[model samples]
Target chain A: GQQVMQIPQYQHVQEGEDFTTYCNSSTTLSNIQWYKQRPGGHPVFLIQLVKSGEVKKQKRLTFQFGEAKKNSSLHITATQTTDVGTYFCAGGLQAGTALIFGKGTTLSVSS
Target chain B: DTAVSQTPKYLVTQMGNDKSIKCEQNLGHDTMYWYKQDSKKFLKIMFSYNNKELIINETVPNRFSPKSPDKAHLNLHINSLELGDSAVYFCASSHRQSYQETQYFGPGTRLLVL
Candidate 1:
């Protein structure tokens, strides 16, 4: 069975600080997707990485995919109170397969 | 308009009762999925349907049955619900059944079994 693992099950940071969450998969993934869930809200899709060693940025957030396609990372610069939420990483094995989501990293930012 | 929607944003029932959660997608996606998020926030996929056909069925209990009435609707029925069944259930849809596709999730249905 394929499994996706995320580190820092919980992270608390102050405003203007940086935060990062790492994800690793037990098996090589065809693609990886990132999601964010705010308090009492549903998960929202943020970005996806399919190519190896790929790096994508969205404003102050940066996403990186490992060369082996088995790991990924999300980094946020100068975190704000609006950035408080749980970040999840989901890995897909192949076409038509359900994604395996890692235990999300919950981020809490205090001003 | 909501891309994906589910009925009964919250459900509270006693153990041994039966309940159903309904999901509909207006994104014209061929694939729909149901995932459960436990208290620990571990998200696990329970079932998936593509074009009204069952595609992925995980190792979930038989008491948990998923019905796909049409390509745009997927419903989940739980029988003899237990206390352990308390969790947030989410419905999501993707443009296709491919792994590379991004999924759009609906506001989850929170179920609590007493």
Candidate 2:
């Protein structure tokens, strides 16, 4: 069985501050996907990293995959009120296998 | 059009009652999954169906059953639900051609068992 753990289960930041969440897996993953769930909403696909040491950026959000493929990170630069949500990191073990999700990091931004 | 859609956005039932939630994905993905999000927003995979065949079955309770009548639809039926079953159930779908593919999720069904 694969297990994913996320750090800083909860985070409270002032508007315009930065935030980051780290995810680690007990087993090496083939790929890792990040999702964001707004309050009272479903989890929306954010990004997916397949290659080792891959880094991708979307607007103010940056995603990085560790070289070992066992860890990942999501960093948000200059967070805003709209950034309030729970960010989850899900690890893919193999082809056709289901994703094992981390507990997720809930972000609260105060303006 | 919604890529993935679920029925009964909210469900409230008494303990020991049985209820079903329906999910459909027009994305034409081959793999569908059921995930439970607890009060803390921790998402856990409950089951997965690939091409209408059961593929991933997590350590879910026997009272919960999932069925995929077709590639585009997956339904979850919970029997004799308990108070602990109060959580949000999400249905998601992925291509499954590769493990790295993105998954599309429905709005989610909030179930409250009293």
Candidate 3:
């Protein structure tokens, strides 16, 4: 069975600090998707990386896929109060397979 | 308009009860799925359907069943629920059956089994 593991199960940072969460998969992934779920909210798709060694950015957030496609990371710079939420990384194995989601890293930012 | 909608935002029932959660997607997606998020926030896929056909069925308990009446609807029925059944159930849909497709998730149904 394929598994997606995320690090730093929980994180708390000051408003101006930075945060990063890492994800590792037991097997190579065809694609990796990142999602954010606010408190009492549904998970929302943020970005997806399919290429090896791919890097994508959305404002202050940066996402990277490892060259081997077995790991990924999400980094947030100068976190804000609105950044408080749980970040999940889901890995896709193949075309017809389902996405395996990581346990997620809960981020808490205090102003 | 809501792309994916689920009925009964919250549910609380005693043990050994039977309950159903309905999900509808107006995004015209050809695929629908059900995911359960436990108290630890671990999200796991339960079932997936494509065009009213079951495509993926995880190793879920026999007490859980999924019904897709049409391409636009997928519902989950749980029978003889137990305390371990308490979790947030989310319904999501993608434009296609491909695993790489982006998924739009509903707000989720919070079920509590006492």
Candidate 4:
């Protein structure tokens, strides 16, 4: 069974603080994607990393893929209230296979 | 204007009853998927349809069936639903490559079975 687990199931931070979430897989991943789901909303695609040891950034958000391709991390700088949401990491194992998602880290930012 | 959409954003039903959740995508993608999110917020893929053909069927119960009338539509029907079946169901679409492709999710349907 392919299991993707994330740490810090819940996090609360003040505005202007930084936040980080880590994702570890029981097995190697072919690729991994990051998604953000706002309260009462659908999950939106953020980014995807395919090659090992890959890192991608979008504005204040940074994503890193481990050399083994079995771990990942998402770091957000200067978090704001708008960043309050659940962040999920989904891993794709093989060709034609569906993505397996982790339990996500719920971020709550207070102003 | 939604890339993916599901009808009846919220559903409440009694145990043993049957219900259906309809999903549609306008992104012109060839692959569609159904995912279940539990109370703990863990998302699991239950089914996938490629080109309107059943491709991946996870360990989901046989009582839960998915219907793909076309490439852009994938409907999920649960028969004799139980209390444990209560969860948020999401519909997503992506390219058929299975990797390097991003999945777009719809506003999930929150099902409450009593």
- Per-prediction DockQ: 0.88, 0.78, 0.89, 0.79
Could you give candidate 3's per-residue lDDT for residues B22-92 as a string of tens digits?
A: 99999999999999999999899999999999999999999999999999999999999999999999999
All candidates: interface RMSD: 1.0, 1.4, 0.7, 1.3
User: What lDDT tens digits, residue by residue, belong to model 1 across residues A52-100?
Assistant: 9999999999999999999999999999999999999999998657888
Deviation of model 1 at A111, angstroms: 0.6
lDDT of each candidate versus the true structure: 0.95, 0.93, 0.96, 0.93
The i-RMS of candidate 2 is 1.4
Which stretches in model 3 have alpha-carbon errors above 4 Å? none
Sorting all predicted structures by lDDT, with the top scorer first, yields: 3, 1, 2, 4
Q: Tell me the tens digit of each residue's lDDT in model 4 across B1-114.
A: 989999879999999999999999999999999999999888888998999999999999999999999999999999999999999999999966475689989999999999
Q: What would the TM-scores of all predictions be?
A: 0.98, 0.97, 0.99, 0.96
Residue A19 of candidate 4: its Cα lDDT? Answer: 100
* lDDT string, candidate 3, A7-78, tens digits: 999999999999999999989999999999998999999999999999999999999999999999999999
Identify the candidate with maximal DockQ. 3
lDDT of 2 by residue, A1-111 (tens): 568999999999999999999999978899999999999999999999999999999999999999999999999999999999999999989876777889999999999
Please give the distance, in angstroms, between residue A1's alpha carbon in candidate 1 and its true position after superposition: 1.7
Q: Comparing chain B with the reference, what is the TM-score for each candidate?
A: 0.99, 0.98, 0.99, 0.98
The 10 consecutive residues of candidate 4 chain A with the worst lDDT sum are A92-101
Question: Native-vs-model 4 lDDT?
Answer: 0.93
